[model samples]
Target chain A: MFQIIKNEWRFLVRSRLLIAISIAFVSILLLSIFLGNYQTQKQEQTYQKATEHLRQQWVSIDAMNPHSAAHYGTYVFKPANLLSNLDEGVNSVTGNVLRVEGHVQNEIVHSEASQMQAVSRFGKLKSALLLQYIVPLLLIFLAFNTISSEKQSGRLKLLVLQGAKPLEIILSKTLSVWLYGVLLLIFVVVVYGILNFQNLTAEILTRTGLFFLSYALYYFIISGLTVFLSARWQNATLALTSMLGIWILWTIFLPNILMSSAEKWYPLPSRNEFQSAMTEDRSKGLDGHNPSDERGIALEEKVLKEYGVDSLSQLPINFDGMRMQADEEYGNSVWDKHYGSNRNILHQQKKSFQLGGIINPFIALQNTSMGFMASDNLHHQDFLLQVENYRRVFIKMLNDKQTFGGSKTGNWGWKIDNAFFKSVPDFEHRPTQISVVLSNYIMDVSLLILWSIVVIALIFFGTKKIKIV
Target chain B: MIQTIELTKKYGDFTALDKLNLSIKEGEIFGLLGANGAGKSTAINMLLGFLNPDSGKVQINDIDATKNAKDARKIIGYIPENVNLYPYLSGVENLDYFCRLAGLKYSKTELQDFLASCGLQSEANDQKVSAYSKGMRQKVGIAIAYAKKAKVYLLDEPASGLDPLASKELSILLKKLASEGATILMASHDIFRVREVCNRIGILKSGILVKELYAKDVSANELETLYLKFMQN
Candidate 1:
């Protein structure tokens, strides 16, 4: 069996067509890796510049009202890790810069897709695109004729006469072709390792290892199924056509249709509807700015009673700041209700998309690639949640300064020094740890494994009906 | 030795091979002459364990080819009408690859000798098979089978489109294998070549063996007349 597989490799290596194709393919893959790395590095440089520049401005602020400082918000730039060079995933569509201030929770803005000219439907020439799309297609083309060509050219009969069982021959040929895809994937991974020799981490290595494994599994499925089909059918043309049809269906048509279906099944509210509903809920709470309103008057009375003062002038602390802090807490609840529901909808949509992987493993590959690279919508949402949490902390600090900084009631002229602003912690985007976040990708991994099992089973069981004649 | 007992095959409503039986012993070359769809290839396919007989059994060297085709194929060698090989591989490489498939290993020099001994030129041994003529490919194909030291050779249409010189070489090679105590079953359209090389000949018409005779008893012209008469009926 091993010798038969070696012979298959010998046959493939001798073909000038294979050599030519390999040269072209490797050159393109290297170019894609270089470009993806360059783009990610440029993004890193931009983020560092923006972050440092924003912090510098914050440190230089003079004395100002705490609420005034809240209005002058700072922006937090999302961090791009090394693996983003492989699969940008939702990174291109989800903007990286998020504003953290007071009152409203701002959406991250300035996505690469929005900023770039809309020309290529296939985005940047990333390594993920080539490894995910082109490599498997090449494997299919090579494997689709692995057995049918022999059967059609009358070599299968000769080989069978030479003492090779049909299943053994089919499996050896399939492995020979599958190894081609694994080799390509390994080349990319080794290149990635070399490029990040100084910066390799446990998370990066684990993700890269799993990335390679996922693609290897996918490649085997492709080769196994294609070779099985080649043997099952009588001619190379029919086998090639059928495999091509499957490729198109799995990678192209089904993904879009399923994503659309998932969205329709677990739909998210429109932007306007979401904002208006949040606003309607917020209106039911006390308006912090309106001191003369009924809720504010009631709050003012309660605070005076607690402080044992007869009126506003008798109060020792700033009642306005106290009311503002209370209002901010109420606003946080409104943000949670709306954002939490949206997150749930997105999760449902993602789950549905993942379930679709049982039918098409390509979906699993896409999701796994994005997930491991921390570039999927889930990761993006995690970034937003972290930023929102930071915002709560940031605004509370400002509100507390006003409420307890020896400022009396209605003393709007009270201010804090730049020292307070400098002491306030800067927003740093801490991504969720891999150990905590890995559960989200379990379905993708299982689907990929299931796909591998099914294809291998088909190859073994289907060989019985190969029709060597 | 090669033997088939009441070998029969059917394709839906058509009887492809109907209760056929043949016994060819060692050191004998038997030729099967037939029309285009006369079940000659079908019989060759069955003997090679390529297709199952709907109702029959094939034995190669006394091993049942039907119940255990892989084991039976250990002693069988086959060359099809076109002798398909890896077009990108050299003659020697193709021989070595197929030999390895049959679990036969040889040094480079031994592989070259096998090709050289089978009448493939030394220069052509290293040249890719894509550039080889039909005769050269047949030489390598025979070398693959010969290197295995097979006990039986099942050939289908072995001389359909070869030049006269190549056809003569093929006949000589078949005779050489028979001389070495290998049973050769060849199916062909070339009547003169069949009479020149075979010890016995059988004519098949519409999946039935219509006539059988010794090559020594019939002249080439008489055999052709007999085959034509069978085709007309």
Candidate 2:
């Protein structure tokens, strides 16, 4: 098998056209890595600057009402990790800067895709694009002729007569092409590591390693399937055409069609409807602005009775702050219900997309690549959850200060000093661990492995049908 | 030794090879003469274990070729009519690759010696097979057979596209291999070349062996007359 692979390698390198293609492909992959690194560095710089500026503003706030300070709120910029430079996943389309404030939950905004012109449909040339799309196509081109050419030229019979089993020939040829794909992947990854050595971490290295493994599996599938097709089909042209068509379907058509179907299956409510539903639910409870609301009145009466007082003046703390906090608690529940439903829908859509991997391993590879890189929808949702939790903590502290800082129910002019504002901790985002993230991609990873196994089995079993004559 | 018993093959309703029987002993050269579609190639294909006979058996060195094809093929070297090789690889490289496939390893000098023995010029040895003539490709095939040290050689129209001089050289090479104790089975339309090299010849007509004779007992013209009469009938 090794000898056969060596022979194949020698044959490929001896061809001027294959040599030229190797040079061109290597250059393109290097260029893509450089571009991806540049974009990632730019994002890192922007995130750092935004975070510093927000932190400074938070610490230097003037003396003001605690409630007013809660209303003023700050922003948190998502951290840009090293592997995102390679895969990017949904990072470009999903917003990175999330605004955390009092009373209302804000959506992330200002995504890179939203800022781009409509003409950028195919997206920027990133390493993931080449690895996922172009490299597999290259492998297909290399393998589509692996067996059919031998059959066409009548050399297959000679090989068989030399004591080689058909299964051995097919497997060795497929491995030769698969090794070529893996070599290209390794080249790109080594260059990426060298370029981002300063940013390397254990997690980044692990993610990059898993990324290579996933792509290696995908390439094996591509090479094995193409060689199998070449052996099965009598005509070389027919084999090449069939493999090319399958490549197009796997990479281009199936992903878009399945994504659309997933969305159709688990559609999200429009923004208007979502906001109106929240408003209607909140109105049924207490309105922080309107103390005369029925729920608010009931709460006030209950508080006064609990304190054994008949009027508001006998209360020890500001009922206004208490009411404000009550309103916030209620609002949080509302946000949870609606946002949780949306998140569930997104998860359902993702699962639906992942199920497509059984039929198209490319989809499985895409999901696994993004999931490991911490750039998929699940990662983005994790970040939002963290930010929302911080927002709740920051707002609750301010509301607590308002109720207990020697302020009356109607004293709207009550203020807290800059020292108090500085005491509230800054919002810091900790990325989800690799283990946690891997759990979310279990389906994708399983499907990819299963697809690899199935394709290999097909190649081994399918070669038995080859007609050496 | 190479033998086939009741070897039959059919493509739909057409019987490609119909219950044919043949035997070629060690150190002998046997030539199969037949018109197109007379089951000559089909018989050779069966002997190489490239096709399964519907109800027959092929034995290479007394091992069942059908039941254990890979083992049976270990001693057989085949040169097809076209002699197609890797167009991108040099003749020496092609020889080296096929030698490796046959579980044989040789130094560069030894490989070149095999090619030289087979009449392939040293100058053409390092050049790509794509630039070589059909005769050169056939010489590479012969060099591969020599390097494999195969006990049986199967040639399918080995002289079809060769010049008369190259064809004569190939015949001499086959005679040399047979003299070295290799069994040779050749299928061809060239009755003159068959008579020149073959020890015994069989004329196949409509998937049956119509006539068998020794080369020493007949001249080339006599063999051609007999073959033409058999083909016509």
Candidate 3:
């Protein structure tokens, strides 16, 4: 089998067309990696400038009430993952910078205008795009005629007469084409590694390894199925056309149909509808600004009674801060209910989309590839969650400072020091561990494995019925 | 040795091969003569285990060709009319590749010797097969079977498109293989070539073996006349 595989490689290497396409393929990979790095750096520079300007504004502010300072809330900028050069996934359109303010949980849309320069969005040349779309097509072209051409030319019978089993012949050709694809993947990855050698981390390596594995599995399936069809078909044109048509269906048509179907099936609320619902819920709660409102008056009375004070003048701490913190907590609950439901809808969509992988492994490949690169929607949600958690901590700190920092009830004039303002911890995007990602993506990987197995079995069975003449 | 007992094949309602029995032993060449649709190819295909006979037995040496086609094929070499090979590979490379598939390993020099001994010029050994003539490709095909040391050789119109010299060379090569204790089965329409290369010849007509003749006992003119008579009837 190895001999047959090696011989096929020799045959492939000798093909002028294969050599030409291979050189072009490598060049395109190199260019893609370079462009991705360039885009990442460009985006990073813009983020740094925005971040610095925001920080300088915050630190330069004179002593002011912490509540007002909380209103001048900072931004959490999503840094580009080191492996994003391979596959930026949804990061380009998903909006990287999130606005974290005291009153507003997040104005996610505002960040797009305020921070992102839309660098990756203007027709991005992502390596993932090429690897996901073009490499498999290349494999299809390589393998679609592997057997049928022999059958067409009457060489298949000769090869068999020379002691090559039909199954072995088909498998060997498939492996050779698959290896060619793998070699292209490795070239891209190794070039990426060399370019980013200093930035390489264990997580990045793990992600790269997984990315390679996913593409490799996809290539195996493509090659095996194409070659099996090649042998199954007696006419070379029929085999080539059938494979090309299937490739179109798998990579192009099926993904769109599945995505649209998933969306239509588990529809998410419109942006305005979501905001209105959240707003109505927010209004139902006590208004921290209007302490005399029914819910607020009830709260004030309860607090006054607990302090054993009849009026605000006798209170030792700031009641306004307490009221605001109460409001913030209520808003937190509202945000959770709305955002969590939206997240659930998206999850349903993602699940349905992933399920399509059983029928078309391309979806599985796309999901797994983006997942390992840490640029998928799941990780994007994690980033948002971390940003929100930090915002909660940040606002609570300012509110507590006012409540217990020796400020009076009506002390609008009360101020906090810069040192206290600067005391809030920096927001860092915590990466989901590889283990967690793998566990969450069990279905995608399993489907890919299943596809590989099913294709091999089909080829094994297909060889028996394939026309020898 | 190759033996087919009551070998028969049909395509839909068209019986491709009728019940036929034949035996060709080692060191002998049997020629199957027929018109285009005379079931000659069908007989060859059935013997090669390419097509299953409706009712028959095919045995290559000791192995039942019907039950264990892979093992039987291990000792059989087939050179089709065209002998299509990898166009991108050289004559020698194509030979080497098929040989390797058969679990035979040959050094570059040994491989060149195989091609050379089959009358493929050494100068053309390294040139891509796409540049080779039909005659050259046929020589390489013969070299492939020769190098594998196939015990049973099935030649389907092996000399059909060859130039006169190439045709004579192929006959000589097959005779050499037969002399070296190989069984050769040549299916062809060329009565003269069959008379020259085969020790015995059989005529097939419309899925039936109508006549069998010993080449030693019949002249080429006589065989032609006999074949024409069989076709007419």
Candidate 4:
């Protein structure tokens, strides 16, 4: 068994093609790591400038009736994750910027995928993608002929006559292939760690470690299956073809079919329907320009009576401001009815997307990557919610000035001090933290862990009783 | 050194070897002669424990070849008919590799000297096997058997590709190995070569050993005639 392993190593050393491919794989890993870092830095700079612009706009707002300022809203954009470059996940397909204003909760817009032509369906050609798809296939290519080629050349019979146990021979061949795969991955990882020079936190370390371990198990699964097939087949060409076919099914065909089927099973509402439904519900509420409801008119009359004012001149507060507040509060309810339904639909879409986890590990990985990057549906939701929270505080501050700043009705000429403008809080968005993002994707994590376990089990138990002849 | 008791082999509905019994003592060169698909290779494979026998057992040096294959394999060296090896390696490296597999390690000089003794030129020892001729490759196989010091040598038409000179060299090598008390079992259709190297021979016909002849008691031409008669019947 040991000699078999040694011979395999020597064989690998002598194959120039294998050596060249390994080097190319390592180079690609380095290139991806560098590109990811460069892209992340560029995004961070853009975000910093956008944040400054929003702050400047807040500081320059003109003095006005407090209630009117509520209509001038703010915006918050999703921030990128530290490791977003390693695997962008669904970040490119999802929108980032969210608008928050009085009486309306806005949807996130300007998704990267929507703004570009589709080119990479396999997703950005990253190291992880190669590790998951290409590396295992390469291993199968190398090992599928391990035994069948020997048999075709008649060395298998020679080895058998020399008294090698079938199980030991199989294991030695498998171990050789497994070691090669692991070594190639480790070489890339060591290079990644050295280039990044970043502090390896427990989370980063664990996630990276899991990535390595999972891929190694995936390689083992391929090696065991290939060896079994090679031994059973009579021809070398047939063994190679059959092993490649299995690779295609597991890595490519099945994942794509599963993704599309899962999507069809849990379809999301079209964007047009989502927008129209929200608009229709909003129109049914208080129309600030033209109030058509008799009840709304009666409520205005009752408010005048309670205030003990006639002809709107004796009122202490600004009548226009009061009217605006009533309209704004009414509109808030309308926004709730419409926007709340939109959020529900999005949640449904997420549930449907997540259903793909059971059938396709690639889907699970993609979802997990998005969740970690803070660019998935949950991160978009958090951004909108934060913007809405800021809108409330900004509007309330303006309303307090109108109701209690001793301003009379119809005082359009009155002006507040610049200090008062500065006193109003500006919009500041807090991004979803790494922990929060990871928590939302616990199901994906579970699925990945499950796959790793199943593949490892297959290598041991599924192939333990394999017959060579 | 080797024995089989009513050994048989079957693949699906096709029976390759029927119930057969045979034995070869130490220091004897046994030849298994048969036409294609007549169970000569099948019998040898059973003795090597590479394939399982359906209805019998194989014992090598008193060890059951199937259940305790490793113990039996340690005492054996196999030379395949095609003389195939890792083509990227030098002749010395190939010999070193197989010898290590057989649990023996030799220094480079020791390996080169063994190759020299096996009819390989000193200059060819360090050159890649890919650049060597078929006859040169056979000499490396012989050198591997010499270096491994195997007690039992299994040769399946091992001299098929060698030239007349190389063939003569291999016959001498086999005679020397047998003289050193090594048990040799070879399967071949080369009746003349078998007569030159083997002491006793068994002729297999339609999955049965139909005749066993002592090479010393029969002329080379007579053994060929006997093999043809058995195969025809």
Candidate 5:
């Protein structure tokens, strides 16, 4: 087996076509890394400038009412992961800038895809695209004729007569092609690492390493299946065509059909419907501006009783602040109920997409690749959750200041200095741990492992009935 | 030794090999003479453990060929009509690869000696097989068989496309190998060459062995007459 593999490697390296294709593949990977880094740097610079500017504006503001300052919110920029260079995932399509203000939750805006023309939907020329689409095609081309060619030319009979088992022959040929793909993947990864050595973190390294594992498994599946087809088919052309057709089905057609089906299966509410529902729910709750509403009256009465005051001005703290805080609390619950349901639907859709991996392992590869890179929907949701939590904390601080800063119920002129505004913490997003992120993609990873095992088993068992003559 | 007991093969309704029995002892060269689709290759394939017999058994060196193909094939060497090898590899490399597959390891010098012994030019040893003539490729095949030290050699039309000189050279090589105690089973249409090299010859027609005779007991004209009679029937 080793001798066969060695000879195959020698043959592949000597072949001018393979050498040319390999060089082109490496060049594409380098170009993807450069483009990714350039985009990331540009985004980082823009966000850094925006954040600094916001901070300066906050510090230079004149003394203003704490409630007014709460209305004037800030922005949180999503940080770019270095692994995104290899697999951008859904980041290009998703928004990056999130606005954190009082009273209302804002969606992240300014997605890169939204700014591009319709043609960008075909996707960028990223490393992930090549790895998922082109590399597998190349692997199929290399492996589809490994056995059939030998059989066609009558060398297979000689091989069998020379004490080489059909199983060993097929396995060795598959491994040779798999090793070729592995080498290409390793080269691209090494180059990517060298280019971003400065930005290498533990998380980045782990993600990239796992990325290699996923792609290696995928390549093995491709090679094993192609070689098995080669052994099963009588001629090289049939084997090549069958493998090519499978590649097209797996990568090109199936993913789109499955995604659309998943969306139809677990449809999400449109933006208008979602906003209208939230608005209706908010209206039914205590109106923050209309303190004379029944809910506000009940809150005021409870606060007065708790303070042992029967009159409007007898309370130690401002009644208006208490009412506003009550209203804000109700609004938070409404936001949670609506957004939580949306998140659930998204999760359902994701699981639906993941189920496709059982039939098409390409889906598993794409899911795992995007997931580990923190560019998928799961990571985006994590960032949004953190921003929402920050919004709550930020609003609570201002409400507390307004109620306890020696202000009366009707004192609309009450204000806090810059020192107090500075005391409130800025929005800092802590990226979810790799372990937690991996939990969300366990199904995808398991499917990939399962697919690899199945393909290998099929090659060994499926060729048992093959007719070498 | 190579032996088959009532070997038969079928493809749905078509009988490829009939219940034919034969045996060849060590150090003997047997030739199977037949026209196209007479099941000559089929018989060789069955002995080499390539195609399973529909009803019968094959034993190679006293090992069950069907049930223990790998072990049976260990002592066998085969050269197809075209001797198609990895065209990108040099003659020596191709020989070395096949030799390794047969569980034999040879150094470059030994490989070169085997090729030279088979009448291949030393200069062509390092050239890719893609550039080799048919005769040169057949010489490499002989080198591979020699290097493997196989006990049984199977040759399918081994002299078909070769020029007269190359065919004569192949005959000499087979005779020498037989003299060295190697058992050879050659399937060919060359009656004169078979009469010259084979110790015994079998004429096959429609998957059946129609005639069996010793080379020493018959002349070239007699062998042709017998083969033509079997093929025409």
Candidate 6:
């Protein structure tokens, strides 16, 4: 086995194709790292500018009603992760900015894909794209000719006669290709580290490093399978064609089918239906202006009777304040029912996406990479939840101002001071850590490990029984 | 010493090797003489433990070839009909790899000396197999056998593409190996070369070895006539 590796290395050093390929591949990896860093820097600068402009708008608000400010609302967009330039993931398809307001929770809008002339389903020409698809195929091209060419030349028989075990030969060939993959992955990761020097926290570094290891295992499985097929098949062309066919099926056609099917199985209702449902539920629940809403009128009569007052003016606390509190509770229930269900629908969509493991490991890898980056559907849901929490706080504060600022039920002249407005907290978005993100993608990690075991088994015992004659 | 008893191989309904019996003495150059599809290569392949015969058994120096193929294979060096090697590797590198694979670790000088002994020139030793002629490649194949240091040598059409001089050199090498106590079994259609080098010849017809003749007892034309009779019958 060692001799085989030695021979392979000697041959590799002399082969211009292998050397040129490694050089070209490594250069491309470095170029991508530079491009990714530059692109992220560009995006962060634009985001910083946008955030400053929004803050300026926040400071210049007119002394209108507190509820009116709630209606106008503010927006907080999630910033892109530092490593996003490496993967670029579903970021292009999902929205970045979320709009928060009172009495209504709005869906995020202004996705990068929507603004484009045409959406790219395959995503941008990024490093992860090459690492996932092109690099492994290059490994296959390197390994598929390893054994069949030897057999065809009668060197295989010569080696066998010299007491070399078949399994040893297979291992040596597999190791050669595996080493190539390892070097390629390390090259990309070293570039990643050099570019993102600041964000090298332990969790981030570990996830990013595991991401490297998973991809390396993926490359090994693929190259080992290719070499095994080459040993089983008689002709070199046939082996190459078979390995390429498997590559296309796994990387291209299979993922599309699995994704589309998962989408069909876990259907998320259109935005229109969701909005209408919330509106219908909100109208029947409670309205601050209406004295005839059966539940609200009942509650009001009880409050008046208990306080022993003939009119709202006889009450100790402001009637407007009591009404605002009643309205907020009702609106909260309505959101809980409708928006909560929508969130569940998104979760269901994610669960179905996890079922793609049986057919394609690249899908598993895509999930793992995005999950660790905190750029997948789960993180998006968390962002929406945080926006909802902010909206609740913003609305509750406005209700407090209306109830306690001495405003009457129908008075339009009362106002809160700038002090109260300035006291409202701004929304702060915190992305989930890599460990928390990876926890949600355990199934994907398991699937990748499973594939590695199966391919390794095939390389070890599967070719021992091969009829070389 | 190599022996076979009623060795046979069947591929579903078509029988490739018939029930056959033969014994090859130690230190003798035994040639398997037949045309294409005559089972000469198949018989040699079975002795190398490449194929599982449907019935009967083969022994290499009293070690059952089927029951313990690894043991039998350890003592045999097979030179396949078409000599295919890694064209990217130089002659010396190829020899060194094959030698190492056989569990031998020789220094570069020793490897070069072995290559030279197989009639490869010092200039050619450094050249890749891609640049070598057909005869030179065959010499590398012979070098692989010589490097193995096995007790038996099996050659299937070993002289197919060689020029007359190269063929003569190979014949001389076979004689030297045989005289040095290496049992040699070769498959070839070259009846004249068989008569010139091999101590005995066996003709396989329709998956059966129908004729066996001593090389000195039979003249070239006489052997041809006898081969015709076996085929006609």
- TM-score for each prediction? 0.96, 0.96, 0.95, 0.85, 0.96, 0.91
Per-residue lDDT of candidate 5, residues A1-469 (tens digit): 9988998899898999889988887888789878877877787788788888887887777788877887887788777766787788888778888887778999898887888865246766678888888889989999989999888898888888787788999999999999998988998889888888988889888888888999999999999999999999888889899988888899889999999999999999999999999999999999766868999888888888888899768877877777777788999999999999999999999999999999999999999888877778898888889989988998888888888877888777988888988888888878777877787788888998999899889988988988888
Docking quality (DockQ) of candidate 5: 0.79
Residue-level lDDT tens digits of model 3 in B1-233: 99998888988899988888889999999999999988888888877888888898999999999898878888888888988888888887888888887888899999999998889889999999999988889889888888988899988898898899989988898888899999999999999999999998999899888888789999999998899988887
lDDT (C-alpha) at residue B69 in model 5: 81
Model 1: residue B61 alpha-carbon error in angstroms: 2.7
- For candidate 6, give the lDDT of residue A468: 55
Give the share of true interchain contacts found in each model.
Answer: 0.95, 0.95, 0.88, 0.42, 0.93, 0.90
Candidate closer to the true structure by DockQ (higher is better), 4 or 6: 6
Candidate 3 chain A, which ten residues in sequence have the lowest lDDT sum? A110-119
lDDT of 6 by residue, B68-123 (tens): 88899888878776677678888888888788777888898988888788788899
lDDT of 2 by residue, B120-221 (tens): 989998998989999999999988888888899999999998999999899999999999999999999999999999999999888888899999999999
Runs in model 5 lying further than 4 Å from the true structure = A310-312, B56-61, B64-67, B216-219
Q: What is the lDDT of candidate 5?
A: 0.87
TM-score of chain B of each: 0.98, 0.97, 0.98, 0.94, 0.97, 0.95
Off by over 4 Å in 4: A1-9, A62-68, A118-129, A157-207, A210-220, A246-253, A284-358, A373-375, A391-417, A420-431, A437-469, B11-14, B92-126, B139-149
Interface RMSD of each: 1.6, 1.2, 1.5, 2.9, 1.2, 1.4
Among all candidates shown, the one with the greatest lDDT: 2
Q: Give the DockQ (2 decimals) of all models.
A: 0.75, 0.81, 0.75, 0.45, 0.79, 0.69
- On residues A1-469, what C-alpha lDDT tens digit does candidate 1 reach at each position? 7877888788778778998999999999988888888887888898889899999999889998887788887888888767888888888878878888778888889887888865135587888899888998899889888888888787887777777788899889989999999998998888878877888888888888888888888898899999988888877888899999999999899999999999999999999999999999989887888987677788889999998989988887888788888788889999999999999999999999999998999999999888988888888888889889889999989988988888887788889999999999998777666788889888999999999899889987888877778
Candidate 3: TM-score? 0.95
**Model 3: lDDT to the true structure:** 0.87
Q: State the lDDT of candidate 3 residue by residue for A1-469, as single tens digits.
A: 8977887888777778889988988889899999999888887888788887887777777788989988888888887677889998887777776788887877555333334455534436789989988898888888888887788788878877777778888888989999999999999999999989998888889889988998999999999988888888777678789988988999889999999999999999998999999999999997988967788888899999999999977889899999999999989999999999999999999999999999999999999999999888999898888889999999999899989989999888999888886676767668788877688678998999999999999988868877786
lDDT of 5 at B194: 92
Candidate 3 has an fnat equal to: 0.88
How well is each residue in A1-469 modelled by candidate 6, as lDDT tens digits? Answer: 8888878887878899889987888788778777777877887888788777776676566575777677778888777678676777777788878787776677788887788745454466567878888898888889888889878776777777778788888888988888888878887888788778877788778778778867877887787888898888988789899989888998889888877776687676687887888788888877865766787777778878998988777766556656656877788888888777877877777677776765677788888777776667777778778888888888788877876667766565676666677678887777677766666788888888898889879977888876657
Better of 2 and 4 by DockQ: 2
